[model samples]
Target: MTFHDREEELSALTTAFETPDHEFYVVYGRRRVGKTELLKEFCRGYPHIYFLAAQEAEERQREKFVEHVADYFGDRVPRIDGWDDAFEYLGEKVVDEDVVIAIDEFPYLVAENDSLPSYLQSFVDEQVRGTESMLILCGSSISTMESEVLGHESPLYGRRTGQLDVQPFSFREAREVIQYDTEDAIRSYAVTGGTPMYLTLFDYTETLAENVQSKILSPTSVLYNEPEFLLRTELRNPARYMSILESIALGHTTPNEISGATGIDSGPLSKYLRKLQQLRLIDREVPVTASAKKSKRSKYSVADAFLRFWFRYVEPNRSSIEEASKIVYENTIGPDLPNHVAATFEDVCQEAIWNGIRHGMFDQYSEVGRWWYGEHEIDVVGLSPTDDRILFTECKWTAEPVGIGLVEKLRAKTKHVRWGPESREERFALFSKSGFSDGLEQEVDDSWTFVDLEDLEQMLSAGR
Candidate 1:
């Protein structure tokens, strides 16, 4: 499990360390997203002290913190009575030297003592400021990190030198971790999403079905109840959140539809939706061409691919899993898994396309996302509002080569998209898992870009 990507984040942290001024950085993301690992990697070869806070009483946590500080200093440090005392000890030890003091799972400490942030603010202002010490506060609770640490009313609002919201790896990064062919790598990513922890658990040598059965369907597996564990950790009402997530996974995307399926009122449902969105468990999507603020047609979908798979397959078949029924994996999961992967493959292709856009491989676009109108849906749309140009894309995740008929179908849908005037210049791109047909390759000219597995592998392998 070597660190694969995160060059940008590592670079930013290295820059923070190089600066002479004291730095207070807030880093937070969901569990197993590598926040702590990222900090540990940054602290390597440097004079740093990392303290992981546990879910314990305030006094107990302070004693542990004091012990860690003492160990770092190699001396008999006095017992810390409070956070202020702890930070004071830290400030004295790293006043002149470039030292990193990272507190992992910081929200656990905040939960024990509500006034921890204010104490931290005082410590930053009176002790750490103007020094070469860098204090990195890390947490997994997105809501707590947002409302308590970086919120407008937070005590340490203006005190932080920088903030890093670490996210899961993209498909390209995931490929580096899961060593497999391009098609199989895509399938593995569909199951693990971009989460490094889950990706590492997958045995690439085994068949996808075997891996799914052993690593996911088994009751003893680490990922068996992973989504439940995360929900319980972050939310007070885990059952309610689970119901909402299950509804979305079952294709109940609209508010009314979800409410109908879950038997929850729309008013309370909105709050649950907002909370889940804040946690990054689900996302609300409007049409790519529509204004986000004014768009009335919004669909909710599970944001994490692992959670999507869990809710769709595992959660519903918990009894079968407990009973060790092979039929559950072979009949139910095995049959529908490819279709699920197909949907996720579209997302991966969109990400690959976005990477191309960032590298100036595609025309400049103001926005890019999935677009739909009535019964027509375009997989990917890159819109350059100023230039009156739009790139409509279709992603096919099938074994067979995509033919010209699919391109024709995509072209027919493009005419219905109303972004600008009818004279708007249009570009078309197609991504296929198994390359394209000869007819498609010959029919398309310079305006059309056909991206297959080989092209995608090349784009992903550029920096490898």
Candidate 2:
């Protein structure tokens, strides 16, 4: 698959390299989020040495590192028993030149050698006054990367000139890569959700069900066991995290609710949720108008769309699921996939609206998210108290066209939202999958925006 939508990240790295000084950059993100790929793309055509670290003994890792360095330089390297000697020799060879030395999976090196940061700190200190070399340390372990290298208490603190936290693509950027129609794009985005690697596994020609069966439902497919593999690789207690994730996937959103579903004690549940949030595997949702620290009604949900789908449709039915079988997908998955995809439709609707605001297509808002208080729930809310403006959107993902009744239902809930003063200006909008009724548009106020999937796609795909 072709690389897509990282102009900002690539531009940042290029800017650091163009400077005539020593530069240290740390690039990190979730697993398979294109950290390595982005780094490689940035390194193209540069005099660079790239070494991928693995879970191995310190001595073996150092040996492999020296070998890669030698292969790049095409010169005989002296014996380097420790990191200090290794870096010293490296500094000696690449003296005062523009070269990039990127160490991928840097957390693995830190894991093997706890003092690896100290050694690198020394290297960076020397490079500061000595060479124009750029050192890029990249990793997938969000916790380890943040705590070990980027944390203030670490030896390498303040050593980095710049950092890149490579993130997943947005729905608009992902649509360019997936190359599917609006309907299937939503389905594919719900499954892949901006993760570049997973998005590439799908073919635009195939239907959503066909793609799901071959790429996800099949036991032999790469993504079939992806969530489990990632959990085991990243966490010490995969089973506990799995239970919490499965609970959230099953629609148990609150701490008490997750505890009730998993039978895990509520006291320890916060730690797991915090850890999952740090890992970017789950999201803690608070009302759009409320602060996270103050919101008592904050809820947890599986942050990764693919993982949510896996936990929802794949994990529960694993016992009865057959490899590469259509029966399971046809009978069970197909029935529920629409509802599953609907949840993401609400998210993208918010995203599209927010992106529109960002691009000056709409009024700027300070926040955009779901706002819920008991029985009153708004699917999408854009609030800017500074501007004394709030926008509410009613998003429907049903097969039939939406009518004025749904519009009226959304208006009824607006009075319950306790935001801004009574004099604040308000806006109403509707986003539908199957479009809206013709008469319904005329019935509603002319100021209101009624957007269907096609318009939403155009707005998003046109660089939202």
Candidate 3:
């Protein structure tokens, strides 16, 4: 709950601050992933001046910036009209030690004045760059930050000493935020994502269904309009973005399908998708070894669980939210969530299995992912990149026992799919919630592994 897994980034930032010379750093990420929180936490005990940029006229923003500088300096300070004068005054005011200046939502500041970057570059080159002060620029829009500020052609391109793109908390870190079973934790993660704002809404003590109803189903809630806020900030056309997001939520992943479903031209859709991917709202994936730029088999998905939930349920139920109607919202969202959560649970199970493999707990797989060819889809597939060894697995979220019949079905589904050189040497695995049938468990040969929710839970607990 308290800054999990950010020690490395924080240490780097600390080093930048402790250096004898000036340090300029850029911190960017998708919205609500705690970029500002991390900076504020790091600012503790330091002589720091923090100012957030508001979407306002240039003159008003300058006044706001001047007021913050005056407050940080303590008492009635000089009146300044522009950033250049305020920065110059700070240079003349400070005598000894280091000063930390953080500007949150720096992109918004740049938008207010297109020449601000050049002005800052000139100021740093002429004055601020020679001092021991540390200047940090923070923004939530990755594309704008990277292009307008950090891009090679930008005025401040090489002026910074460090750059940090802080991603969401990992699944391991997320588990500590709540105490749910393996499957339930994954379900929560998939829906809430690793976003601190969304994760804070989850009450681990309650059932998943209860949490959903309490956090999301209500009329006045923090997250009810989250998707809208994020979309409107990053995009000019919220309707077009919603269409693409809804299409992905409804199980369309390819560009062709998304364009076809949304009626947006594929050429223009690419821009929207790229922006969303930069914000971490969606993800574009290719086969593990595929080329980074050109991979025909690449697919896109709504990577954020809460975004997916909103697209699948809340967006479709817009009328309900507007009309303050609960009957339609609950009845529609209730039954569908389990199936959705169950599929996501399998993805979490696979992620857990990969973590085990990484730590040398499992020697079977060197690579793991979902495999599909035509209509044949394997929920979980692990293949050894070295020896070409392969493992096929099926994950069941039901309470009923997983009988040998399920295994037979897996075998049948995989009949046309060959594994390495010898099919006989291939391994089989079953992951279940209620676990395998007793007789069926006895029937499996030594070439298979049977793991249930309890096993996964124990592994996670031990790892923690």
* Clashes found in each candidate (C-alpha, N, C closer than 3 A): 0, 0, 0
Number of the top TM-score candidate: 2
233-352 per-residue lDDT for model 3 (tens digits): 777778888889999998889999999999999899999898778767888876443444886877888887788888888888877766764565467776676777776777667876
Q: Give the 10-residue window scoring lowest on summed lDDT in candidate 1.
A: 455-464
**Residue 305 lDDT in model 2?**
88
Q: Tell me which of candidates 1 and 2 scores higher on lDDT.
A: 1
Q: Which is superior by lDDT, 1 or 3?
A: 1
Instruction: Tell me the tens digit of each residue's lDDT in model 2 across 133-173.
Output: 88999999888899999999999999899998888888877
TM-score of each: 0.96, 0.97, 0.89
Encode model 1's per-residue lDDT on 1-464: one tens digit a residue.
56768889999999997897899999999999988889889999588989999999899999999899889889797967778888788778877666889999999999999899998998889888888889999999998898888998999998899999999988888777887888888888888899988988898889888898889988889999899889977988699899899989878999999999999999999999999998999999998999888998898999988999999999988998889747898889878877888878888878877778777678888799998876889989999989999999998888799998898898899879988888899999999988888776778778899989889887656545
RMSD of each: 1.5, 1.4, 3.0
**What does the lDDT read for residue 340 in candidate 2?**
88
Residue 122 in candidate 1, Cα distance off native in Å:
1.0
Give each model's whole-structure lDDT: 0.88, 0.87, 0.79
What value of lDDT does candidate 2 attain over all alpha carbons? 0.87
